[model samples]
Target: MSAAFEIFLQGTPGLEEALAEEARATGFAKAEAVPGGATLQGQWTTVWRANLKLRGAGAVLARIGGFPASHLSQLDKRSRAFPWGDVLRPGVPVKVEMSTSAKSKIYHAGAAQERIERALSESFGATIDPEATVVLKTRIQRDYVQFSVDTSGESLHKRGHKPAVGKAPMRETLAALFLRQAGFTGEEPVLDPMCGSGTFLIEAGEMAAGLWPGRDRRFAFEDLATFKPDLYARIRSEAPQPRPLEELPGLFGSDRNAGAIEMAGRNAEAAGLGGAVTLAHRAVSDLERPAGPPGLVIVNPPYGARIGDRKQLFSLYGRLGAVLKERFGGWRAAIVTSDGGLARATGLPILPPGPPVAHGGLTVKLYQTAALR
Candidate 1:
């Protein structure tokens, strides 16, 4: 077995606890939530599994190795002496990124990055490309240097299966964490009346079918020297077969725009959920309770900062609240919005909102309610 190392799961800022919950539920060892993300101790296989299974992490980073460097010359000397060949293959293109703090003597991030890049190129014979697939992240804080590898190439939210997205579409990583926050266990139905591109519905349906989020995607870890094809293949095969769509709970979505509905259907089919998700081109005012036991009604509506006028959205929110209160008895609701006033306009018995989450340059919160009377 490979030696264990520190693995950091970068999470959505305000929803770190939710990500921590998911990490623990997924059986990661020593999973602890921190300010920006979660941490765990694991081996190379664990790193691969994290990239494959963790739905809430924006990126998975492996803390390879580092040493304290009080100055630029020391940083360059130690960096050249470090065994870069153990994890990084020679001749492969790579990128170096650095962050520094005032507590560190090496407070110049750009200069530090240059030293590390030169060391890799001259001493290790590695190609440094701005657009490289592999990224080496360095942090210099309190006079200590720490090195980590960005094992995930692109953001995990891409999911590789969703190529078409509507305006201001919710990220899959954030969507998954929000679902966990809403207490969704994949055992009940989920409806999204404002389902642009069907992100919420598709994520819910995928969970119900026991699908893995990274099953369709590739990661930068595969390009590392530590990657083993056979071991990774076995891990992939260990995933449970997807449950038949009929055996899973119903997943429904609706949008007032016909174009949005078409895009949603295409994305669902691409995700192997063609028959499992039901979508419609209908307004939120026309939404009706499905013929089944009560479940969750979750939506990510347009906010005034990004989409529409604040005053106009109040009536829209009011009508939505009225429809749910009058017809969807015993069901719960969760709304993701930037304006507390907009969420308040719904007039559902909302609990205190979750921590503010940064989304698309705006801070948003998740407002939820207990099952309606």
Candidate 2:
């Protein structure tokens, strides 16, 4: 098995460069970000580190084995010619997925699957079931079939710690992306006054202390025969120790719902940032800016489409703006919403919203505002 691998990142605003930079920060060399993903050359341990350290990535795909075939007959012949014994054994079941963007005539996915199954079964007498231990993803982008294996079993957002969540919680990946966009580096205080489940705060804490996002999870590729556990172990051993907790600033979160504060506190503890994050059963109107320099206030309050009521959300946005304007002078703010009318309701002079992002299956825009004080 080769040490190098390709990683796929899912985000808006074309963050391939950011993803590649994050990988490099974690010791992955020769990182290159492509259109939808980043390519890095490293050992098997690098694969483990990629999943663990990079917060912006979605999944890590290992280039197991592949051969180019321009036509259906050639695809069958070339696929059968590869030696499956190195990666697949006789007993393991396998799953197959395909993507095509080519001029070749092998357009039918069912036909491609048939050819692959036949080649595997005929060559090795292996029982290739429709459902099995292995998942094979095939991409025929630009007339070239590139097959790879998925290393991450579940979505990397699981993080294995947030067992409970609050209403309209943000995805960890999205939170990280916003942090990067807002130029958050974990060096200053972070406040999420409308904090729900504390995803943003936890991500900030992890960023501050150099905690790997994937440390608690397992990848599907680990079960493959070609996986080298020792290499993964060596990589983990070489990772930098967690940052001293004392260096991290106080992270504060508040919500009107006492239950939400309780959930946020639990999640912070689960993330080992319990001491750094302070969750309170208070409303945003009551929040005071921290003593330090201007800090960040990010809110993903209920929007019209998200909450299914335009009037209610408009009132909520107005109240939210009143609170920020009265209390949080000198603080930078980022408000994410799917409706332009709600953003206008804030009364905070909205900078033209940045890239539209897909959140909760809704196309949302990020409206940035700054405190006059």
lDDT of each: 0.93, 0.76
lDDT of 1 by residue, 200-303 (tens): 99999988898999999999999999989999999999999899999989899999999999999999999999898998889988998898999999999988
lDDT per residue for candidate 2 within 1-373, as digits (tens), equals 4545554543333556666777676667677878766786654556666777778787777676576676788888877787777766556667777666646567777788778777767776667655564677887654567777777767778898897798888889778877877778888778888898999999999998988888887877677666788877776776578888888976888999999988998999998988888887887667766777777888888887777789877777887788778777887778888898899898887778867777887878778876545
Model 1, runs deviating above 4 Å: none
Rate residue 71 of model 1 by lDDT. Answer: 95
Which is the leading candidate under TM-score? 1
Residue pairs clashing in model 1 are none
